[model samples]
Structure formats: structure tokens, C-alpha cells
Target: MEPVFEFPLSLDKHGPQTLARRLHQQLRAAIVEQRLAAGTPLPSTRRVAQAYGVARNTVIAAYDLLMAEGFIVTRPGAAAEVADLAQWRQMAPRTRTRTRTRTRPAPPPAIDWRKAQSSEKPIGSAATAASARGFHLGLPDHRWFAADVWRRLLLHSSSFALPDAFGYPSAAGRPLLRAAIARWVAYTRAVVCTEQDVVVTSGAQQAFDLLARVLVAPGHTKVAIEDPGYPPLRAALLAAGAQLLPAPVDEYGLIVDTLPADVRIVCVTPSHQFPTGVAMSLARRQALLDFARRTGAVIIEDDYDGEFRYGSDPLDALQTLDREARVIYVGTFSKIMFPSLRVGYVVAPPWLIGALAAAKQCADNGGNVALQEALARFILDGHLAKHTRAMRKRYASRRDALLGVVERELGEWLIAVPPSAGIHLYARYRDRRQAKRIATLAAHHAAGAQPAGDFLLDRQTTFDSGIAFGFGYIDEAEIEGSIGRFASALRGSYASAD
Candidate 1:
């Protein structure tokens, strides 16, 4: 097979190396070592010749021999690539980034100059001033997804006749998948929208990006976000170069009566408010929509976790209540399926769906089509519905298990804000220092356990000001032990705080 990496042209012209034989051996070694994985495109013939100081004919002969040996596959016109590494079983994810000390001279442009670092800080932290130990507020529980099905779908999709699917995919995203999304939303979220209204996007991040691009006109627009809300939205709004006004929220959710005068976009998480798990009251939903209508502001309904509510029946999505086409609904599969899925959709007003679709097309040409199809089929075939129901039951049980533990063992240590639904709840310790320590202790027990302060900026963000740990991602057996450690950590942390 052709090598996964660029073939070294450094074989000695008159040395003991057989130019062709040496090339074949190197190719074989790379494939065997699993460095040159299957399907990786090899360097061009012209480039290979230039590298080895050999003629193009020599490289071509070597490549042909490799192909003959079933080591590589050469497309008629495209670059020669290694055969699929179907046999290579993937192991553990590289938690630590490995740095290489190379003897070769670095290239001028410096393309491969540095390797990825295993820094404790995430990109989200570096840019937003968010802490690494923040609450599980912005992201979803990735462990709940059926990733194997999607992976199989990816393999099948690549094996299809069309790689790019012959031509430009729909800017609104794949039609079959969109239809699936429409049906899935209808069944799961109880929202009303069709395939025509669904505009596939990178994720809720890009949903905001595309929506902001179309709706918000730099200085002329003002968008309202929850007072103690997602920083990413605030970051995105600021980056979008729009003015952000903090809308007040309380027990029932964002105070509709206190909205600002000139907002063109209003972002809300009616299902479960971030940080504080308050469901928006029906009165509040109507008032918010009414306020939007009166002021002509488009309500940007961030239904990020609306699918996972507890106790009460499904609440009609705010967009369903929009008669004036005022609600721009953004929903994501990241929470329900997996975050890396990066698949979200905006059911824009029918007239404006075209504009939003155009914006999406320009953003990244409608996301990964194969993934979209796989997810679409998954949802359409009822696997998503079946799996979501199963996970909800599991998460709800864990939530209860945690609440029960804290109630019995460490009741005095926290302030509870239990949700009617959603995977996480907020708890506060009177002393902020204690909160940090408890989170550290919790992490010593479990890997990703953390406090809410991590998501907050010292300047703008606000919440109960506590550590937020999740039982949703872990087992019931671990909860009691985790809580015990959490309590011990809190006491020790506070003793030091004093």
C-alpha cells in the first residue's frame, strides 16, 4: 500500500539501499507500526521524486509494486493512499499529549513545528476566563450516547459511491435527516416544525453564530441574555459585536416584565435555566413572547436541554407559542447524543429559514453530511427516542440518589435547587472557599467533579456561588462515597478558610 505519510526521498543514490526496495520496506514498516494508518493519502509522485532526488518513474514503480502487494491503493487521478486500517483496534484515548524530539530540520513555514500540549487549561478557559473546574452547566453528559452505531454509520457512509455526495449538499442540511429531526422534535420535545424549517448547524455554538450573523446588525442590535447565564452566549454576543443586556431571572425563570426596550434578540433557556435549574413558568413564557411582539424583538429560544425534563408533562416549546414568527428556536443533539456530534439545528421562521440556511451554508457547508444522516436515521428509526427514555430514567435515579445522600448525610452543607428535569442541579456552600475544596475532594474521588465558579468570570457571571457536582454521569454506588468525600473536603476546606 502507499504510505500513510510522505515517503522519505533520502535513500542514498549509490549506497547499499535499493531505491525501490528501500521505499517498499519503509512503506511496509510504517503500515505495520500503525503510524501510516489505512486510507491516509500519500504524498504526490512529483513531491516524492523531489524528496528522494529520484525520477518520477521510480516512485511510480515503487507505488505500483506496493499496490500490487496489497499495501496501498492508487486512485486513477487522485493521490495514492494506504489501504483502510480496519484491523487496527483503537485503544485508550491519549490523555497525555506526547512531544517528539526530532533530529530533522524544521520546515520554513513551520506547519508541524509544535505538537498538541496536555495543558490542564481548555480552550474554553483560555478565551473566556472560565475555570477548568466549572459546573456541568454549558456541556452535556457525553457518556449517555450510543457512539458505536454512529461510528458504524460513518464507516458505511464513507464506503458509499459519493464522497462529497457528488455535489453541494443542501445548505439547510440533508433533507432525509431534516425530516427525521422534525419527527424527533415532534415526538421528544413536542415542538412543531417541519424539515423545511430546520437548518442544520455545527452546534448550539454555531447556531448562535449563524443566528447572530443574520439577526443582529452590529451596533444597531441589542440581545438580552439571562442574568446568571451561559458565558459562551455572552462571549459569542460580544464577539458578534452586539450589545448584551442582562435580563433578570428568578424562581420561575427570566422576568419577562423587566426586559429592556430595544432588544432584537432575546436568548432564554425556558426548559432548565443554566446554573439555576428553574423552569420558566407558562405565564413567563407568554409574557416573554408578548414582550418580544410588543418590541419586535426576536426571542432566541435556546432549547438546549428542553428534552430532559422531570415530573411534569412536556411543555410546548416557546416557538410553538410564537404567532408573529418572533421565536428563533435553537436545539442541539450534543446533550442527548454526544457533544462532539456538534449537530444542532435552528427552526427559523419559515420566511427567514432561507436566510439562516444561507448563513449555515457559508459557515461550514452544512456540517458533516454522513453524521447528519446517521443521526437522522437513528432518530427516525426510534433509537434516539428509546435511548433517551432509558437515560432519563437512569439520570433521574442518580439525581434522586444524590439528593437522598446529601439529605441524610450532609444536609446542612448545601442549598438545594432540584430541577423538575435535566441532568444537573445547583448546590451552594455558604463559604466560597469551602465550595472550592469540596470540589477538589470530589474530583479526588471522581475524575470530572467540580464547582460552579469555574464557569463564572470574577467580573460578570453570577449564580448560587457553589460547587456543582453531577451524579448523572456516575454510578449510584459511587454517589454515597462521593458525597462523604465531598463533606469531608468541605469541612477541611472551611477549617483552612477560617
Candidate 2:
């Protein structure tokens, strides 16, 4: 039987040592150093020669030399094995010193790593995992996704016949996916753009990060974000060294008049404000556009879940309203399809697309081309729109279930902010002091409710203390039971507080 050798064997043709000599030295060292234990079999000469691209004569000569030195033993029609070296190991001279030197402690790092990680706090309590079941924020019902259809599309897109499918993908993203995104956004969100204006990204987070990398002048750029805004976006901007200014939001959305005049960038969720679920008023939308135009500041419109509105006609996206090319619109499939998909797009002005594409190239060289192609087909085939419509109905039912339960059981203590769109409901606690306590206690009762205070950018800001209940992941049937658990926790919190 052929034997196996795990030790590495190398030969340098140009070196002073001959091929056979070098192989012999390495094998000898491996056996003597105990890397090759006693009785361990060595590969056949032909196998060694083929494996290392060396001649069989060189391997045979090396084996012959080792056998002569009594380091190896060979039998008729059998591979060579390491010799018993127990006596040799005992007689070997000891080289290691008895005393050990003390190792000095490493000096502190120049950059404060703790400060860098400060922005990574979960939207809710850090004790509970963010993706925990029962009302966890920003998670879609992944069970409803059309896995079979997606798999078929993936298989088709990755066909070996298409050479471009295997090549290095475009840094700006695949043309078909970009064009699909342009058409989808234009039809659904009223976003004004063509294929040239779109840049496909891994997800909304990467889109924000790429924009931050390109636009932010480290430590000097002043960027304004909503007080209770998306934390991941905040983290991306902070990593780029932008000075974050927490702008206030009321029922109308971001208070445009209150924004600092010198701010260079404004990031807002105007379609449906995150956590609060308040759609920005048309007057306020116009006011923000005017503000951006007057201050020469760019606006990043995160139309995260704008497609699921249940009430009146949805307002035009900020990108649709922008006439001076000051808006950068970002959208994601995480809420519409599933978070793991990690597909999103950005619609920017023609001039800025180059910088964003370059930044994207530097970040990841581009997203998965095959996946992009499949997603493009998914969009073009109308599967995305169909899936979204079905999920919207499902989410709407879950939303109603959650709202009904919250109003029926916990209405006295929790006053829900009127929700016009989106899958979550934010309710301010009537007693501000007990809101955080209730949210913490609810986690122990298996209800994953997040404190509104946890999302606030400026903790000192005079916003009402509340809780956010996400309905996207929770089933309609389970909503009542989850709310019951949360209610029990609420009563316990009140009892303890009293």
C-alpha cells in the first residue's frame, strides 16, 4: 500500500545543494525533530516525485541515504517507515535553557479601540441578542421568502456557458441589476433615475459606508442625523470621523428649520421615519429640500420600507423632489425580501456616481455578480413586486394584531404614536421613569421589546421615554400572547417601582 507523508518537502534547482541532497536533508531534519514520529510511513519515491514535481531518482537517492543513516527502514514491496529513535532522542544533547526571561507588557494602542466600538450598541438592550424572536426590530419574516424560485434563478444565472458570470464583476455593479433597480425605483417610489444613476451595493449599510468614505472630511464634516435614527448608519458615519449632530423630529418628521446651517450632510428617513413610523408632511419635505438647496448640504434619503404603506397615497421620495441633485436615495431588499439577501441600491447624481463607484470598488471590488444577476432577473420577472405585495398584506395583519393587543392590554400605561406606515409601532410610556424598566423586564418574559431611549442619539434630548414593538417577524396568531407576556412584565415593573 502507498504511504502518506504530511511534512513539507521543497527543492531549489538553482541552489548549491543538489535536488537529492536537499530532499535528504529535509527528510532527516523532519524525522530527527520528531515532526515525523517513529513508525510513521513515508510516501513512495514515485508519489513523492509526482507530488513535489521532482524526479523519481532524486527521491530514491534521498530514501537510500536515509536508510543508510538508520533513520528509516524499508521492507520488500513496502514503503519506508521512520526508524525507532527512542535511544537517539534520550542521547540527544539538551539545548534549551532552564531559566525563562520575563515578557514586558505591551504598550497601549495609539487609537482608542473602545471608543471606536461605542457606536456598535444594539438598538435595544445589549443583554439580549438583537435577532431574538418576538418583536425584534428590522427583521422581516424570512419564512415567507420564495426559496425555490430564488434557487432556480441562482442556478440559471450561474450557468457555465456565460463566461462573464465567472469573471471579475464590475465595480459599479452588473449593468442588468443596475438597470433593474432604476426601473423598479422609478415605477414604485417615484425616484427619478435611469441605469446610469444607479449603483448597486451589498446592502444599505455598505451604501451608507461608501457614501461616508467619499463625502466625509475626517473630523471636520458636520453631519446631521435624526435623534432616534438608524444606529448602523450612525456607526458608518462615525467610523469615517464625521461630527454627528442629532436633529429633532416631531410628528411631521425631521425639524428642518432647527438644523445647523453649517452641516454638510443630512440623513433622514422621510418616507416613514424609523422607530416612530411618521411620514414626513409634504410641506416639511419641501422645506427640507429648500434647506439643502440653501445650505449646499446633501440629503441621504433612506426609503427603507416605503413600499408597505397601508393608508393614503405615499409621498414622492426625496430623490424625486430634488431638482438640484442634492439627494442620494438609498433602498434595501432586507425589509422587502429578507435581511440575508444583502442587496440594495443608491440613486445619486451623475457626477457623484463615479466617486461612489470608486469607493465601492475600494470597499469590496463589487457585490456578488451572479447573485446580482439573479436579483436582476427576480426584479425583471416581477417576482420582487409580487412577493412584496403578499408580504405587505401579511405584515399589515401582524401590525393590526400588535396594535390591537397594545391598545387593549397596555393602553393605560403605553400611548402608541399614531402609525401611518411601516411594520413597527412606537409607544411612549405615560410614566417616563418606568419605560426602560418595563422594556428590560419584558425581555425576561420572552417578549423582545426595545426601549425608544436606546435609539436616541442625544440622550439628554427631551423626548418621551417609550418602547418600540416590531411586528415584521412576529406571526399574527402569536401577537396577543407576546403582548400578554409584555403586559405581565409591565405590571411587575410598576409593582417594583411603587
Candidate 3:
């Protein structure tokens, strides 16, 4: 077993216990330098007591202090991880902005005619909690992934890949990874692509940002997104100064029949709609493509986690059926491999990849090459498929646990819409007003309360409102409890909304 440092007797005294304070200082420094990583196996309470001749509770108290300050995470059976330093850097305070606009402008009727996308907020809402760990959105548990193999590959590749990769990696990404991605997409999403078709990105968000940078002509072009959709997409578009429109989604996905005539790009999650787990129908897909072809618009297909299908044969992705080369396909291992992998690919129409790559080169100077090579080998070595299969089962089990918890707790109070695929599940309140009230009071209850209103276009009819739960990140033990709390919160909110 690895030797872990523990508190000494002198450190435990409430007064000037120099040794205890020194141990604390050294441990904090180790954490800062990553000597102690987030989730490292620390010594046991008895072991610490035995090692240092100090009381077991002294060690416990010290660890507890570090944890409360966001320095570490402790699981029941697992060792503590070095609190994510990268996440910590992101969580630093920025200039806070208060909403000066008393209310939203009265948008024109039928204004959604020009946008193509969903699940986005109007402006980047301060990216406030980036550093605090245990986030609830699009985060899959990485514990199940086979890291040893990738670690080996990264180690092996780092020695030889420096000359070609370190200085200026291809704007198109490494050719080997691109080819592997091409193969993965053909078999999985059924999209035909060469290595040239793939432009590796930081994640799907970057792909959206890149497209917004290249396609949207600032205020001159209007973009449409799904009403009550992903907030980040809307924020990215707005940040690019695009006039965004919120398109309504239903059982069929984005209602293309009502789409505006002038949109240059349509961003969509047809395989599994964001937040709401509805799959886009084939009829809707064809209609969207038809409209894009007629309008000369680009279709940005974010095939996010389309592989975890529970029932029904997976429908071909929109890009798979695009004959006009109008569809740009986006896929991310961020969901499948875990969020930190941060590698998502854009399979674009031939003309767009070059511009986007230049933008990428200028932006972040290419992603981690070692991780990229590791990912490439992972797919080539067939670990990607195996990991996906394992995770699908794990997630499926988690999904079952979530359903049981909601039914057991909320029962008739919450209507659970079972997901076909994705990390999250969505719900509409039987008493939405009450649900809102509970969510609003979540801070008081030590929970989060995100209203569905922020996702809508300020039109009451546009909001098919409910709660969003990212169940994949939470353990089974907490699923039922979370739902019960949510239901109870909703009960409280019911009184407030009235």
C-alpha cells in the first residue's frame, strides 16, 4: 500500500500545534501541485492513527476541512481525488452583470421562422459554476472507462508524436484519428466520410461556436433554435451577435413546416432531442433536409449520444441521408468517453472544414495531442466499442433506478418520460406552477431550481415546462431521494407561483 501522510500529535492540539498545522500546509501544497490528486486513496482513519500516534478523529477533521473548502472529493469506498484544478481555474469570479432590462422585448409574431437549433440561452449567463465539481449536465461517469489501455497508448505515442504534433498539429486534426472517426461514424451513424470530412473540435460546443463564427453574419443573419432548448447554444449564437429565433419542438422534433425561409444553418439534435428525450421522426428529418436544400441552408447535425438506444432500430442520422451535402455532422466522445475527453468531431460538407480549422488554429491552438492519439488508438484497438457497451448497460441500470425512484416518491405527482437515449431525463409537472416555486426555493433547501421559463421565448405556450435531471452523474442511492426532494420542492413552489 502507498504511504499516506497523516496528522501528528503536536498538530492536533487546538492551541499552537505546529506539527498539525505543518501537516495541513504540506497536504494543501501537495494538492495544489497535484501530488495528491482528486480521488487518491488516502490512509484509513485507523491507519492514520497507527502511523502518527495521533487520534483517528484528528485525521478525519483535517480531511473534512479540505473537503468543505472544495479541495477533495470522498466516496464511500473510493479514495479521494485531487480536486479538479482545471475546474477550479474556471470557477474564479468574473464581473457580475445584473439584468438591466426590466423585461424582454415584445418579439414579433411568427418570429421563429429564421432559426435552426435548440436548447440555448440568449446570452452566456456568466458560466458561473464551472469550477465547482459534481455538475449535473451532460456529464457521464468516467469511472467505468478503460483508462489503462489509453494511458499506455498515450505514453507510447508521446515519444514519437512530438515533431509532427507538438509544434503545429494539423488543423484537420491527426489523420489517424480522423480516419478512425470516419469509420466509427459510417458504422454507427451511417454517414459516409473520408478523413477530410472530419474536423476535430474541443467538443460540440466549439463546433457550434465555430459554425456561429463562420456562418452567421452577425446581426444580418437570424438563427433559430428549439424553444426550451440548450442554453449554451443560444449563448454562443448571441455571443456571435446573431439574431436568434427560438423554434418550437414537438413529438416530431423541430417543426420545419413552420421554419423561416432565410436561415443559413439549422442546428439540431434529431437522434435524441436535448432535455426532452424525444427522437425526431423520419418524416420530420426529410422535411428539414428538404427545406435546407430548397433554401440553400446548412443542416448542423449534433448526433450527441445517439448510440445508446434502448428500443427500436436506430434511425439513420440526417447526414447519413443528405444527398445535397448540406448536412454537417457533429459527434462527441465527451458523452461516451466522459466529459473531460473534450474531443468532438465535425463531419462537414467539403467546403466548410478549412475555414473552421483555421478558426480552431487561431482559437485554442489545437487540443491535447497526447489525449487525441490515445483516443485514436482506443477506437482503433476496439476499446471504444467495449467501453460503450459496458457504459450502456451501466447507464441503463441507472435509468431504471431513476425511474423506480421517481415512481416510488413522486408517483402521480411527477410524470417521468423515459429516455430513448442520453445522459438526462426530462419531466413536465402535473402542477408546474408548484414545481417552479419549489425550484425557486431550491437555494434555501440546498438544491438547484432552474425554471423552464429561461429556455422559452417568453411565450407561455412555447414552454412545455418541467424539470431537468442529469441522472447519470448521481449514484443510485440518491436518485429516489433527489426525486422526492424535487417533488417536495415542487409542492412548495406550487404555493409560490400562485
Candidate 4:
């Protein structure tokens, strides 16, 4: 004999509330309170109607309401069972007076987050303010992106008849996209790799995170990072329990001699250093590689915005010069394309590829298949190359305008740091103390910029005070006026300081 399903609910006959509504409310409360536990089956509608002395239609209506609200589930030839109410329990009314006196103690947290350092907001996260006439960093001009072409490709990729297209994608990545990335990097950045070497990631941030997880042995590995470097990369390494050693950078890029001898990994932006906007000299690149070879240290070369250059031919990438297979080349389409596309790739040596793919699998199961397919077509069809050429010209124009205006208006207070490539321009303050004050004042005048001190790991470290102006967000027509406003702010700051 089966157990009888009972409704421990009461209905008020004289109350203004309808009996059906009353019954529904009580049943919902019971489920929320776990009085009717998840998966508990309910009696038949006829049995419920007969036991409660209610109309059969009333019982059916209440059950229908419960089913609609997801409080219960039913199928053909099966009794209605209570649905899992874990999510619903969280949203249940807290103001309701509890009939039970016992309360369960909350479980302890899995990780002690209080001891962890908070990550800084990544560059280009200010997309909402990109349209404003200000110097926002790490943003690409989305106006030139071929959205219609991308839309068509996205639609086409979504309509594939292959069963594999709809299933969980390969953790290593779609072979077509990997091949496309391999070819694209080989031609553009001269990174030597094949499809077997590429591992697709959500973004450059995820690439750093996956690499940290695979390479860093929590609290044991010593990783040397460029001081005042990319914060997201630092956050990832720190989270993985690697002890970070801050290596100083000069005009030619990271100071290889300053790197600790015991360091197991070195993270660098050789093509174009962040915040400083200086490319690594060939001698320094070779020295760093030699250091890696001697000490068995791995190098992560982040060529984030290397595609855009203003002057003569850029130097060969560090990855191209690496002979020992110690370099892991990381690149992203975010700078060339839009940031929200969130597509990046890593070209690792044969030995590290397996570990990176496994880490990627554990991180996100792999990137979006449809997006990967669309990007592969975008690259193989020559859309990315054409777009790069067009944007490079436009960005160059804006860069020129910013340089001319800064020299003409703010020459007395700022000295521009000449950059061979990349979208942003870095300028040092004539007076170090004035960098932060001037930047704060400039923000009020709609000329937003970041103080260089914000990038340093140690705030008290003696370094040149400077500011970075990203021309990617501001248009050519707006550069002069925005810098002019910034010039006014500089004058005001100087006057107050005097």
C-alpha cells in the first residue's frame, strides 16, 4: 500500500479570501518552509477534493496555479510532486513570522576572501563613458566595426546542421578557429605556431588566469612581473598563490637585470608596455630570452595593442626571437576589434599546450563556439586585416591631433613620451606632485585620464609622475577642445599650488 498524501492546510469559510486562493497561499508557504519537502508527491485531485470537502474544479484550479508558479510539477499518469524550492526558498519573504523556533546555523565560507587582495578595474571597462569626449584607455572606435558582416557570420554559424555544433564544444577549442588564429598571428605578429599550439580563451584576462592556475604552484612559485604593469595579470597571479617580484621598467621596456634570479616566471608586455607606451629594445628582448634559457623561467609576452603603429616598421616580437620554446605568446582581438567581443588566444610551446587546454576546460569548458566559428571566418576571409588597416589610419589621425594640441597648450607642464606604436601616449609631469592634482582637476573639465602612480605596486616607490592619454575613445574633431579643457585645468591647479 502506498503512503497517503496529506494537506496540513486550513481554509477559513467566512474569510473574504477565496478558498482556492487560501489553499494556494498555504501550500506555497508549506513548500517555501520545507514542510512539503522537495519531490514529495501530492494526493490525486479527487482525493484532495473529497478529503478537504472542496469542489473538484477548485482543487484542479489550485493545482494548476501551483504548477504554473513552478511550486509543483506533474506529468501524464504521475502524481504532482513538489518542485525543488532551494532558489524559491532564498526569495521567500523574510518578514513573515516563523511558526518554528529552531534555526539552522550558516555554513562557513570555502575561501577566506577577507585576506585576499581586491583586483583593480581593468582598462577599457569604462565602455559606457567611451562616447564622452575624454581620454579613455584601451577602447577601440566601435563605429568602424563591421557589425553587419559579423551579424551575418554569426547567423550562418548558428544554423549549422552538424550535431557537434550544438553540443559542448571541445575544451581545446574548435579546430577551425585555432587554425585561423595560428595563421593570423604568424602573418601579423610573426609568432611561429600551429593549430596544435593555440588555446582559445574568453579574453586576455582569462588567458592569464588559466596560465596562473597551470603554472603557479600556490605560495611556492616566484613570478617576476613588470612594476606598474597590467593589474588584471597581477590579480590573476596573486590569486593563484604566486609570490610576485616587482621588476622595474625603463624606456626600452622591462629591466631584465632587475628580475630576481629565483623567479620561475616573467610576465611582460614587450611589444608595447602598458601605461608607459614604450616598445622593448631588441637587445633587452634578447637578454630576457637568454635569462629565461639560463634560469628555466617561462616568459609571457602580451602583445595587446601591437597592431597599431605610427612610425617605421615595428621590431620583431619577442615570441619570434624565442628559440628555446620558453615564451608563451598571448594576444587579443579586443584592441583591434571591440572589447566586448571578449576573444583572445594563447600560442604556447608543445609542452605547455596540454596543461593550458586542461586549465581552460576547468575554467569555462571553452569559449563560445558560434563566436569562435564567426571569428574564424572573419579572419580567413580577410575581414580582420582590412578592418585593422582602416582603424590604424583613423587612430593615427587622432594620435597626431592629441600630440599637436598637448605641445601647443600644455608644453610648460607636460613632456610627451614618444611612442613608436600603440593607441595611447604617455606624458610626464614637470612637477611630480602635480600629476594627481592635475588629473583630478582635468576630470571636472571632461578631460579624463589616469595618474601613472595608480599603476605602481608600491605607492611609496620613487618613480616619474605621469599621465596616459588614450586617443582611441576621442575623435579627431574632439581632441583639441578636450586637451584645451585639460590645459585650463592645469593652469588652475598650478595657480592654486603657488
Q: lDDT scores for all predictions?
A: 0.71, 0.83, 0.72, 0.84
TM-score for each candidate, following the candidate numbering: 0.70, 0.78, 0.69, 0.81
Query: Cα lDDT of model 3 overall?
Result: 0.72
TM-score of candidate 2 versus the correct structure, residues matched by position: 0.78
The lDDT, on a scale of 0 to 1, for candidate 2 is 0.83
Candidate 1 lDDT over residue span 332-421, tens digit each: 987777666778888888878878888877878866777777777788778788778888888788778877877666666677677777
Total backbone clashes of candidate 1, pairs 3 or more residues apart or in separate chains: 5
Listing every candidate in turn, what is its Cα RMSD in Å to the true structure after a full C-alpha superposition? Answer: 11.1, 7.3, 15.1, 7.0
| Residues 1-498, model 3: lDDT tens digits | 324553222345455654445555556666665556656666666786676666777667777767787787787878665577665444333312356678878877432423434443332112322332221556677677787887788898887755676476777688888999999988777889999888888888898888888887867877767776776677677767778677888867898976799887777889888767678889999999999989988888878888777766888899988899899898898788766667888998888888988888887767777777878889988999898888888878778887777666666556777877876766666776556454554334313324456566546664567655665566676665666676677566556657
Better of 1 and 4 by TM-score: 4
Model 2: residue 409 alpha-carbon error in angstroms: 0.7
Error of 2 at 396 (Å): 0.7
Candidate order by decreasing lDDT: 4, 2, 3, 1
Which stretches in model 1 have alpha-carbon errors above 4 Å? 1-148, 161-164, 430-450, 455-464, 493-498
Q: How would you encode candidate 4's per-residue C-alpha lDDT over 1-498 as one tens digit per residue?
A: 322345456767778988888888888888887778999898888887887778978878888899999999997999999999688787567724667678788986533444334444446565444546467788778887899999999998888745678789988788999999999998888888889999999889889989998999987999998877888888788888888888888888999998878999999998889888889999999999999999999999999999898888989988899999999999999999988889998999999999999999988887788889999999999999999999999988888888888888888888888777788888888887666677677566545567677678766777776888888878877888878877887787778878
Residue pairs whose backbone atoms clash in candidate 2:
none
